[model samples]
Target: MGETIGYARVSTSGQKIETQALRLQEHGCSKVFQETYTGGSTTGRKALLGLLEYVREGDSVVVTKLDRLARSAMDLGQIASTLEDKKVDLVVLDQKIDTSSPAGKLMFNLIGAFAEFERDLIRERVQEGVNKAKEKGVQFGRKAKLTKQQLESLRNDFAEGELSKGQLAEKYGLSRSSVYRLVKSEH
Candidate 1:
């Protein structure tokens, strides 16, 4: 039998990993990796990255729940594929999923498919809401730093060559890049 490693994660510092860690220990995990990360993507999760690097062929990775392992079905599929390629087993305690068994693998795939479908539905709904808001004249993105009158005045001042771009930016309480962008927009 290979070594069993554990991973414990909480989305925020306010949450605790003690419960998950204890459960992993009781489940015979020799070492437990822990992290507190709020990002939906796993790119910035240091502990998870480290755990993935440390596990070798025949080793097993255990997590209390699937959500602790990944935020989305695509992410879960990627992680699971990585483990599969490395010849490592994945065990999700709450879901009773063990990739070492055929039935467990099937169950994991089904869950991932459902999760992906749900995410797609949510995305479609959000896009529809955004479209409706736009139709109602709701503006998105950052507000313009300068009004039309201010832009015209700035353009005229630049055309007159009385002051440099830096001077104009200082007078308008804007950056040199902003001044350049505004001046360029006029053309």
Candidate 2:
């Protein structure tokens, strides 16, 4: 039989992974890889990459929770697929997910679908909220670069041909496109 390898992760330095490491050790994990990096970010994930390279067939990967392994269902699915390809088992302690059984595989699939659906709903709600706020005249994003008086002067300068769009942009410390947009708004 192969050994059980554990992985523990915490999102920030302020958080501790000691609890998770202890849990994995108690749960029969001989080796544990711990890291303090955001699960969503793949860059600089040295521990995870090392674990993936080190595991072999008959070895099982254990984690305190599914979120400790991945940020999204798509990412989870991809990681699960890689483990399956190498004939390695995945055990998520908190979620009670073990890929060694048929039922576990089914549950993982369902969870992935639900996760994706939840993200989509959140995005839709946010977009709707932004639209409603716009209707209420609540502007979002950065404030305008040029105020009303400056825009009026810019329009006058452009109309009088005293300066070109490029010259106006340089004088006002704005982009040429901004100068064009301000001039167009007057007509």
Candidate 3:
């Protein structure tokens, strides 16, 4: 009924944007915006942002797959919400999600909920891993690689006033902070 605008993107330069473009043209899209680079995030994507900016109330944005539009579920929700806000709809050919339909709206909500759930699960898994690591006495962040012997040598040097922290770090292939930690750990 209104203008159909196609937006196509390939993660890499080598991907054939032509197939999607041809599909869009066959679907009678007036024009298409094809991006050659990966849009992993919303911040640096010029073409995707431009497509969103140019979309009007009566126009529809088409894509081959939902993933082509976003990298993560959060990203998908954000972009979809923008289209919803602008009174525009999305036609993800692979997903068969025409946001103009009740089924499509339901599908979108379901997908968003699933994505959120996935994020929560990943967070929980990470916390569990951290807890397990702590139980095993596995230190997080950068570890103190120096042995007791090396630390003892550092302490001996410091006690004799032969080397400052900087010189000790230089001599031992460690940072000044590492030297300080080594000195503290020895005693």
- Across 104-150, the per-residue lDDT of candidate 1 in tens digits comes to 99998887677667767988999999999999999999997777788
lDDT of 3 at 57: 94
Highest TM-score against the true fold, candidate: 1
**Number of backbone-clashing residue pairs for each candidate, in the order shown:** 0, 0, 0
The whole-model C-alpha lDDT of candidate 2 against the native structure comes to 0.87
TM-score of 3: 0.60
Model 2 error, position 139 (Å)? 2.2
lDDT for 130 in candidate 3 is 98
Models 1 onward score TM values of 0.80, 0.66, 0.60
Clashing pairs in model 2?
none
Once fitted onto the true fold, the runs of candidate 1 whose alpha carbons sit more than 4 angstroms away are: 9-28, 35-46, 71-74
The deviation in Å at residue 20 for candidate 1 is 4.9
- Alpha carbon deviation, residue 100, candidate 3 (Å): 2.6
lDDT per residue, candidate 2, 52-157, as tens digits?
A: 8889999999998877887677877888888999899999888898989999998877776776677679879999999999999998899988888888888889
